[model samples]
Target chain A: MKIRELLTRWVGFVALGIRRTALRATHTARQRIRFSGLGVAVAIALLVMVTGLSVGLATSTTVYDDDIDYWIVPDSESPESPLVATDSPQFSSVHETNDRITAIDGVESSTPVLAQVLRVGTNESDEYVLIIGVINSPALEDVSGLNTDSLTPHDPYYGDGEYNGTWTGDAVLSEGTAELLAVTTNDSVTIAGNRSFTVTDIESQSSDVGNVPTALVQLSELQHVTGATTYDQADQFVVSTSSPAVRDDLEGIYPQSSVQSRGEMTASSTRNSDMALALAATALTVALVIGTLFVVTTSGLELVADRQQLAVLSAMGISVGSQIRLVGAQTLVLTGLGGIVGAVCGIGGIRLINAVAVRTITTEPIAVVSPWFVPYGTGVGLFVGLLSLPFLVVVTRRVTGGKLG
Target chain B: MAGSVASFDEASSSVVVSATDVTKRYTRGTEPGVLGRLLGRQSPPTVCAVDSASLEVRTEEIVGLAGPSGSGKSTLLHLLAGLERPTDGTVTFRGTDLASLSRRERTRHRLEHIGIVFQQFHLLDSLSARANVALPLVETGVGKRERRRRATDLLERVGLGDRITHRPRELSGGEQQRVAIARALITDPELVIADEPTGELDTEAGRTVLQEFERVAENRAVVLASHDRETLELCDRLLRLRDGSVVDQSPPGGSQ
Candidate 1:
């Protein structure tokens, strides 16, 4: 009941404030309020857009396949954001590790992945394509967006851990690679100078981390061609599992590597967290400073101009506390409106960034927008209103000096 | 001069407001800052706006304060209504001394017990006539629907029902003052103080306001201050001031 009464009183005060603001006749006062709202809106928009960019950077992944539930990457590995890291610490004897992980209960399939940028093209032209070698299995669907149905399963090219097995010469090319090299599904392309492969399928897909030309091939074949065959080394292993408990087993399989679940794809879990967080923090601070300053400055000017009105209300027996509440309600209304507009502009900014990213070289979305941005922006706006109260209180007290009593 | 308060019938026992030997003095020069105060600067010249004024009115009495310009009519009204505390003496509203309370408490007491109509028709230009009339009710924590209902009814009573939605800037001077009167009466205050309420209006508007006051004065006690004799003629009792002191009064009382 007490809560209800407080809400009722606040509603009354807010109604009074809004009526005054909406029906006010002075053009300067209206312009002041409009500029304050614009300042808050622009600030919130920038904050939300910057946050979306940070989220996009954090969620970027090299393994684009949806079914891959976990990644076992070396703990010392660097930058997965934008996924252009050339070399990093590798997991040795990945075949042994993959076997151990696949034997775990609830495990669907485990494929050790090795990524290397290699020149793959016809004799006429060549393009440096990101080639990911994964041992395709009946349980796997795709790798780096390349469909794995046509690739030889189980990496038959590795005969008893030796390079003596038959080379399948089967490759799956992304549409980017197909376009870059001007090749089709039946075309042949040579890689690493002496090794050649037949393009069995062409899929229009970009690397999940960012847009890039890519191809998929059998693990051992590329290992032999790239000299990763020394210890059956691979950059990481992608696991498709039905149970989350398999993450613990994957973690224990390789002592030097860390198991990354899909849920851990945030800035904090990534190596580039400092940069992403800095960008986000800068955006927040700028919004805070700009928003708070605008609210205080505009409200002060407005209250000063309404000094006579304040005096009149004081004469009408309005206590200073009640007067503050009325003014506070007006500030909240102003900032709240600004927040809604800012959130909309921010969402549009995120979409624009994503669209431009797709049309240009960055084929994947580099910004993420969420529905919660509206409420968060409005919350910040309310905070700005609260912050402006001390200044407004001083001004009110000046105008309603003890002379009235 | 201090003991010259007029005596009337036994109706003083029911006095809604009583001012006894009230004096208000204002310093008219530059007040000393911290440095000047530290240097023992002399006090500025002072002007006594109200000096040893005494009067009282009972229920249903329409008391008038009449004097030429600068005769303290408005100052006495301000003191009586608790808008400004007297520098000396006491002002009691329904038996409680107003000068003994804090500024906020005094203001609250005025809000609850006294309603005032100013000479300038000080209605907020941003608010509609109905909203302006409901301004006092807002401070008293009245609900919006009820405030609106009461304000609209009061405006209708004042012949401004059609102008409820019109902003002050859109209303004529007489219509604005009428709205002010409705605002003053909305609180059902024990005493209504009008300081030259019709001073800014033309003869026609002033006559209309006087007629409204005649109707309003039927049940409630009013203390109206004006220099116009015609305006004061409507009062049941009259107090005349000269140089901030009440020199004469009518209705079988001597300078009450």
Candidate 2:
């Protein structure tokens, strides 16, 4: 027979089989179908949630926000290596670089940032916190969600490399950090145990950075306090641009530096995280196995129970290929339903996980389910359903082997 | 019925199915003894289900296979239906030897030319009587509407027009058997095989089924396996089996 004709016959057989099986299940086999579907749903939900967490962790550790289009860091520093960004000994004249980058035609705004880990405390006790120093610029407003008005009422005067530059001892503390220090607006906090700055704002931490205690300070004040002003150096320059063409200009600014886009940074971070990838792969394999086993067991049992009916069909001249297609169709329907349910539950699971994290870890969300995961989960569920085909074919051949009597 | 048989003789040509020295053997158990196991060479125990049974069924003829339990009546039916391959000798349908066809080709031949009925009715419990009748046509790639129409007509012909929408469980034994018969004729096959088709029905229901079989046997060959004398009386001829072999042949009304 032609492929088209065979397919047409198989399709008709499967459609009728699915209808009959579904109807029969409603009366005699409801529990088996329900339990199998539930098993598939739970497996897919776990897979989706774990994948979301892996992606979320990767994004949080690398990209800080969606606003900054490009980051200019030392050529030796890679976004995949957070340690490279934080602990690298190389430094750049970020203020000058920012000034040069800001003058480019397509550049929207630019800022120089100095990030350091320092001991922060009250008069009695102290704890380690990440202190990020930023020059007051419009890019800070767009990238950091920082309230510039609270950091400094007037712009700093340190761009000219003047030691007598005006200093603003104003600081912004993350919500968790402020909670730990027990301070509010206008309260004085000690940075590195020497300089005391007044907390002008306490904002919730960005989910991108997780639950690390962090505070923002003026770049000039931080430079003066940390003694980074001998050559006027900063860690990296963050640049914002409406057009991607400015990447060429940013790259030409420094011969020894690399300019990276947000996507590149995310990919780099995910590629380097062996632990995250391993955990995600393990979760996926476990989910696939659990889901496939459930389908195999349930569908195998169904085939056994329906063996006589299959024999009858065979005796009535139905082909073995059509019988296999019948089972395949039934499996697809069951798993397809499970996939939809799982995707919905997984989205809710993401929310629930984030809610719990906020209470326990003080982070907004450590997991995020992207919109694409819906179709992805469904497709995986179907693949898992397809995995049960071998078991189904074996069972079918055994059952239909002239056992009609 | 006699006039229909005479008309079939005038219109039909050649035999629908012929079996010559057919034998079917089944292995009963695992091989015995240590040497047999080591050399992988033991016949074990075997039973010949059908031993050298030869028969011919022509169009318009209803051939009855009369035998006691375990007398290989069902086995012979299976061989004729191409559901099982004979261990020895040949079984041919319409001049084509069954052994010459591959497994897939045999299945296609059965789908296109053979229909079978089981004693248990074997109707899918999920579908209505009409849908059960239409089950065979699904493999033919017939359109849904046409299949339904033809199935409905077959059901009506079998006196099931009012019960067309009833599920198997909703109908009586006789009604369900009628539906099975309708299913058997759905493809308009050249041959129809039934294995104790009326074994589960009451006397009146069995009579109704036998009458329907006689009616349908006008244009097609039917080989039915039954131990019931009344049912056997409906066939144009009867072949009696004993110990897996045909022991006697009875003309119409000879056993009655």
Candidate 3:
């Protein structure tokens, strides 16, 4: 009963406060409230967008990393040479090394994928494409679904039974590469010094960067045509595991090579996108600071101006605490409501920025704007709330002076 | 009802306010300079706002406290209302010493038992007449429906039924003062203090306000401070002040 009564009283007070004031309390500075509310809203919305984008980016990379348990790279690796140099003969052969790592415990599946930046010319332009070599089996089948009915890697132009030992018959093209080359299944493409192979299936790869066309061939055939010494001699190895524990097993097996986890690779790929994070932080900080200052100054100044009225209320049974609440509640409602609205606009603003800037990052054709933006919006609103408190406390205490009739 | 406060001394069950030897002093100037302090000067010149004055009021009486401006009429009221601490005396209300009560206690007491109407009306400009009248119940934790009901009833009785939803600015002076009266009586406090309640109203409005005050004093004791003859005429007894001291105490309806 007491609780019910308290709620009722607070409701009445809130109603009174809201009705008496304009957007804020009569004691609150109007311009300050308007601008502060706007600022808080904007800041909150932007904060939500930034956090969502960051978390999404992290989640996408984490998914990729979790899929690939191990990476095998040359020991002396750097930005200059992502792969072992072509002239290095000993580095040119790695089939025995592949076999050695495949036999390890918890090795669910292993495939030798040769990734090289081979420039291909399309009707419109020429660009570099990554190529991989796969050993057709149930293990590689589980992760990539490359040899299954879904991708249809075994049809004509893709492969024949005898070509497992050779790269002569056909090859598979990655979805992106096939789209770029404007080629269909059964199309033929020349490769590796005049050797031609039929395009059997269009494959999709998580590792392939956006818009890059990829070529896949049987390892032995690629080694034969390109004059590569061994089946694993070409690019990097793609390893899939049923669980994360095999990552350590693969690392222990291939101790001499460097392994790039999915996270590290994606981070490296999206390094240029860090500007988004920085911009978000700066926007939130600027909005919160400016909004807080606007609200506090306006609220504080208005209370000072109406000191006499406050004194009268104080003298007429209005407690100092309730008086403070009366003022604080007004600030909260105005700014909090403003925050919700501003966050919505902030999201639209972000989309606008993205549309104008014209950058290709995600696989989607255009920007993916998140619809719900409460996390950032609430953050901005909370900051505004804190800012309004000091002014509220000071003003109420000063005016009431702990006096009553 | 008139001349009822003379029985304040003998009444054991109905005493509302009791102040004994209340004294308050202001210190001399203490400005930001060495010479001012060297001359024994403070920021403000030392003066007595209220000397040792002991007075009491009983239930169902209206006691008029008349004094010149700055003669501590307001100070003595503040002291009796538990708004200020006496430098050298004690004030008791209903057997509870005002000096002994905590801040919260005093506040609660003021909210539940004392109704004060000031000269300026002090109506919250944002609130309508009904909401303004319901404020004391906010402290009492009453439900909104009940509070509004009581407030509407009070406002209607005060001849403001048509203006219940109008804010203070929308109402005339008489209507606003009526709202103030409604606010003061909402809690049905035992003691009602009116400090120059009608000082700001026109003569007719002032008279109407006094009649409303008279209606409130039917059950509770009213301690009214005013120099206005009309306000004193409504009081049950007159306690006149000269130089911060009570100069005369006349019976109800008596000539000064």
Candidate 4:
């Protein structure tokens, strides 16, 4: 019975503390509520935006929008690294490996990709553009931000290692590259100032690849131009498969190559690059430090100002534990309110970051807001409130030490 | 003057609280710092707030602690109310030593058996007069409906039924004190301690509060510290203090 009574009293105290805190918050909305809440909200907003930007930059290495499940890159290179211009020893037999990978049960299709930076120019100026050579397959037809239909009627004979067999001087340009070169469909451009190719189509800027200037040509043409015809060499293979078992098969195809699933590729790339994580951690630390300072100082001052009221409660036999809980509840209510406002501000921050990035750096957004960040931001706010608890307890104890006056 | 008073009806009334030779001392200034210690400095001076005071408060009596400013009346009242432990003596409430109880246990004892009122009428500014009355009951785990009903009844009894919804700032000083009295009596404690409860009120308002105190003192013991003669006249007995010691103890109608 005694235990039950104690538990009941505790429940009553918590409920009363919550109600009183909320009432006091609303009553003193101007002096108490707005001061701490707005400070915390701004901090959380900046943290959320920083986190979004970090995650976006970390995941931005996925340049292919096609539903390719795995990227087979040379072990000496990374998928997230800027396209490797030089061929590795493993790059020599990629075409033969691609053919073998297509025979796997779960492997729906495979294509060898050769990526190189070439200086393509107009009569007025010239600029370096990334050129990717891919086989004309159904997988390429469905790629986002790429118009491969214009390359159709040109069959899939590029991997045959004979550039003169079925030559079509057809090439596609990314909208960004097209704009940079001031070229349109049917406009002719010189590759390395030797080979001429017609721009068959212009694809828009893709979210996966951002605004990097890029061009696509037939694999055989790129091999012929890059002088890799001796070994049918390519940089990497893009494989589309629905089964996890295909990963093991792809990993064994070459001695000095790696097979990475989409998520694995993202994690691997992000893990190797510490700059983004450091930036995010720094942003989070700055935000938490600012928020903790604001809450502690404001709450400490408030407690000192309200010492007499706490003394009155103490005199009336209210327990010290209850008083501390009251302070905690008040802190949480303020920070929670701030969290809600911060979430809204964070969304706006994400948009502003994207807009600024498009103008200054990439043609796509530099930051993308994850839906989970809403709750993460709010939870962090609550954690900050909890962090302010020890300071509040010290203040309360000092103020209510057996003195009413 | 050095003796204690036990003036209530011996056969019918029982002691609710008793204090014996209670002395409370307070240091005057900050403690000596590291430089002072290195120079062999002495500690801060001390003053006796309450000195060797003895008293017994029985049920069915209104005991007034009367004195001038800094006469130790408030300190003595606090000692009797178990708000502070005496520096050199013991206080027992209902046969249990308050000094022996843990801080948590003492708080629980006060919550269950003692109610205190302050001179400043420390009602939460945000809570309504009714909610203020119900505040103690909330600690006792009373249901909301019952807490509200009892609070409303007390407010009506204190003649503030119409002001139940009013916050402390909206109410007059007397009304706030009445609300404090209602809050004190909400838990129906065995003893009620008030420190200059009427100090902030006018004569008319003070009288109304005194009348409510008289009503509340019919069964439980009441110990009020006040300098007002009008307030003391309503007490059954008065203990007047001077310079941290009790100088006189007598019935209000008798010579001190």
Chain B TM-score in each of the candidates: 0.90, 0.91, 0.88, 0.92
Decide which is better by TM-score, 2 or 3.
2
Where does model 1 exceed 4 Å of error?
A: A1-7, A18-29, A60-264, A267-272, A350-372, A401-405, B1-10, B28-30, B37-40, B66-73, B120-132, B162-172, B199-207, B226-233, B238-256
Question: Model 3: residues >4 Å from true position, as ranges?
Answer: A1-32, A45-293, A358-368, A386-391, A402-405, B1-12, B28-44, B251-256
**Every candidate's TM-score, chain A alone:** 0.73, 0.77, 0.51, 0.73
lDDT score for residue A157 of model 3: 22
Return model 4's CA RMSD, one decimal: 5.8
lDDT of 1 at B156: 97
Docking class of 1: acceptable
TM-score of each: 0.75, 0.80, 0.66, 0.78
Candidate 2 residues B162-209, lDDT tens each? 998888889999999999999989999999999898899999999999
Runs in model 4 lying further than 4 Å from the true structure: A1-25, A64-178, A184-269, A360-362, B1-13, B30-40, B127-167, B170-172, B202-208, B251-256
Instruction: Give the C-alpha miss distance for residue A267 in model 3, angstroms.
Output: 14
Q: Candidate 2 iRMS, in Å? A: 1.7
lDDT of each: 0.81, 0.80, 0.67, 0.79
For model 4 the local lDDT of residue B53 reads 92
Sliding window of 10 residues with minimal summed lDDT for model 4 chain B: B1-10
User: Where's the lowest-lDDT run of ten residues in candidate 1 chain A?
Assistant: A77-86
Q: Pick the candidate with the highest DockQ.
A: 2
Name the weakest run of 10 consecutive residues (lDDT summed) in model 2 chain A.
A77-86
DockQ of all models, two decimals each: 0.44, 0.52, 0.36, 0.45
Ranking of models by DockQ = 2, 4, 1, 3
Which scores better on TM-score, 1 or 3? 1
